[model samples]
Target: MNALLSKIFCAQRVLKNTPPQGEIPDDETLLRRTFRVAWPSTLESFLVALVGMVDTIMVSRLGAYAIAAVGLTTQPKFICLAVFMSLNIAVSALVARRKGEGDREGANRVLAQSMVLTVMFAIVITAIAILFAEPILRLTGSNAETHESAAAYFRIISAGMIFNVMSMVINAAQRGAGNTKIAMRTNLVSNGVNIVFNYLLIEGHFGFPRLGVAGAAVATVIGTMVALAMSVLSVAHPEGFLYLQFQKKRFRLERSTLATIANIGSSSLAEQLFLRFGFLTYAMIVARLGTTAFAAHQVGMNVITISFAFGDGLSVASVALVGQSLGEKRGDLARIYLSFCQRVGLFCSLTLAVVYSVVSRDVFRLFSSEEEILVYGEMIMRMVALIVIMQVAQVISSGCLRGAGDTKYVAIVSLVSVACIRPLAGYVFTYPLGMGLFGAWIGLVLDQFMRLILTSIRVRSGKWLNIRI
Candidate 1:
């Protein structure tokens, strides 16, 4: 196992070198650097996803109603987080560019400005989520029984949005400064804390009160607070790569910096909102298929999300490397990093696909005992295996584009492929044709293929090279 792992890590050493711009590293050196930034990020993402799986498994014991309720909240929660998450993309890109230019003060200023915006947005989202949680759940097609627990979970989690968004943006800024390990460590510790609290609170172990679904929300909020503290400390450390001395004087907004981040982030915000809207529509279609099918769909999605962690990890590396390379005015180097990231992402996806295909049944058995759910989930897992192959390419390529400040085109593609095509196809397949849950997945797979083709075209065209942050 160790030998196989070593070989995988060393695989990039063999890629033919791109023609050098002055002082560009050789292939081996560059690959090693990329690995250093990527592996920790990847492992961190995997661990976080794994914790989510554990959370689902723990809650599954409460009944399918609990699972479905939680599942229903996923897209709505993402919609709330979308704006801050989008801004993090801009924070990362600007930080990477400034770091590459060797302007430490500029990078620090960007981080400071982002922190200000992060707090403001989090407050607004928290208020809306708390005040309208029930309505929001109902809008997503949650039935009465599910709506009650979903509302509880949403309100508590929403109350902690400030901490969660702060932690996320700070970590993103760290990644932009080529310090992925700090973010990785912070996330790992936070997840560890979450799991422990989940065990105690959810089941009332160790004499803790059994708050059930609300317990999960409380645990998550506490975990996020811990992470936020860690993130702030990392950034405040004197020797840290992106240290900022937080002071009243430094907290004032600079209009130009705000404009720059907004310019880059607006498209990302639109993309996320559109994608979330499409997901809600897709979920509603599945929900209409009845509770059993929707529960199975949710279980299958939890399993599939693990594979996404692999692509997400590589995407993080792609964003950092491509942004820094562009900052250095080395478009050729950015291309090389993107190619390397895509290859690594492909390998990870294919390996995950094989594992998922072989163990589909056993995996579903962990989530539910119902024969119908297990059977439907197994079939969905097979589709997920195929989707991962195409999805990885699209994800990594989009990250590369974001790093280049070319978010508008990525947003347009998502609006067309995911927002328009996916749910529309899912509705047609699920109802008019009566294909059921399997039919819905087929629509999702088609969406991935469309995105893959479009993103691949954009990356190859080199139009992103002209984008200015």
Candidate 2:
């Protein structure tokens, strides 16, 4: 026990330690700067994640099939959004670098070029997703009873792809430019709209039609539309930091700009692909265990994702801070900021870990009262509580690397751990090992730790400091 406690303290010291090369801000200054950027992003992400959980809770009212049906569309939906998602990473990093360089025009150019590419890709992917929705869901382990409902949900979501991707790219640029509050405000209003509509549309309350599973999808799309409109208005003002020029000439894509975007986005795209592939495979493995298991898994996943939001929000701060510092030729400051971001993330993760563990069973009950589901979900939540610590650390680590244009390394890690390790491990544990859903979660735990170790090593090596965009 003494050895264990010592090791834990050692780890905490290492995470909190900052390099001496930079004139580090005092603790109060560091905390204020970190929270100034992080809180809005964190709140935005938490609200967005909360909306997903709320969606599950509302849909669960229609029965397990409805829950499973909605869950089935998740991976395929992310799969379709993969390209834009990767591009948005580049957008955020490049915009931050430009902001630090004091090249406002370059930042706006990055925003415009990203928007152009996103639209072109969104159209093609959206059409394909809608056309092949049924076959895709079936391939994802959807069955006779769930396939039709899942397909309908998938199609509605796909139909709104343009709006979602556009808003996402713009918001990414906003975050990179140190304008997190705009995105947070946008999501706050939009998610509020989503919840209100969910209440009215799901079971025909307040004279709204009963659309069932499709209603959830529709509510989500409506929220995205609102988000897109707000995102555009955000950049429409000519005086804003990331304004979008309406002139046709300003929209012209330059080769150098395109090359820069491709340089960062291509690798991040590979990472996104690997991430979605691994996650899709993992979700499919759990789905094969039947609706009750999948519903419980989905609920557990939704709950765990809330913890992820804290890390993700802090990661947004890390990316902007690291990229901007690097752009200003302050590698020491970059190092210091990332170290501070990781420490903040670690604190939040530990807090969430305790909360999830303490209320594990009660939390699952909010979604379902089935005895088997309650049993499976409780165990999963306990595992998730432990996973958040490593998961958040790795996520922030990856963000730091990506901001420094070390996306190739991050992508390689994703390919190895997420695409390769997770699915294989999950299958082996779930089948050969006979650990059931718990076994699959064991696979997830391994994946997060592997990522954390690799990313931590890279961050410590400090090689990412020299990478140029």
Give per-model TM-scores: 0.96, 0.95
C-alpha-based local distance difference test score of model 2:
0.90
Alpha carbon lDDT at 467, candidate 1 = 84
**C-alpha lDDT of residue 37 in model 1:** 85
Best candidate (score: TM-score): 1
Candidates' lDDT values, in order?
0.87, 0.90
Error of 1 at 331 (Å): 1.1
In model 1, where is the ten-residue run with the lowest total lDDT? 9-18
Candidate 2: misplaced stretches above 4 Å?
1-25
Q: Write the per-residue lDDT of candidate 1 for residues 187-249, one digit (tens) a residue.
A: 999988898998888889999999898899899999999999999999878777688886886
lDDT of 2 by residue, 185-286 (tens): 999998999998898888989789999999988999999999999999999997899988788877788999999999999999999999999999999999
User: Where in model 1 is the C-alpha error above 4 Å?
Assistant: 1-19
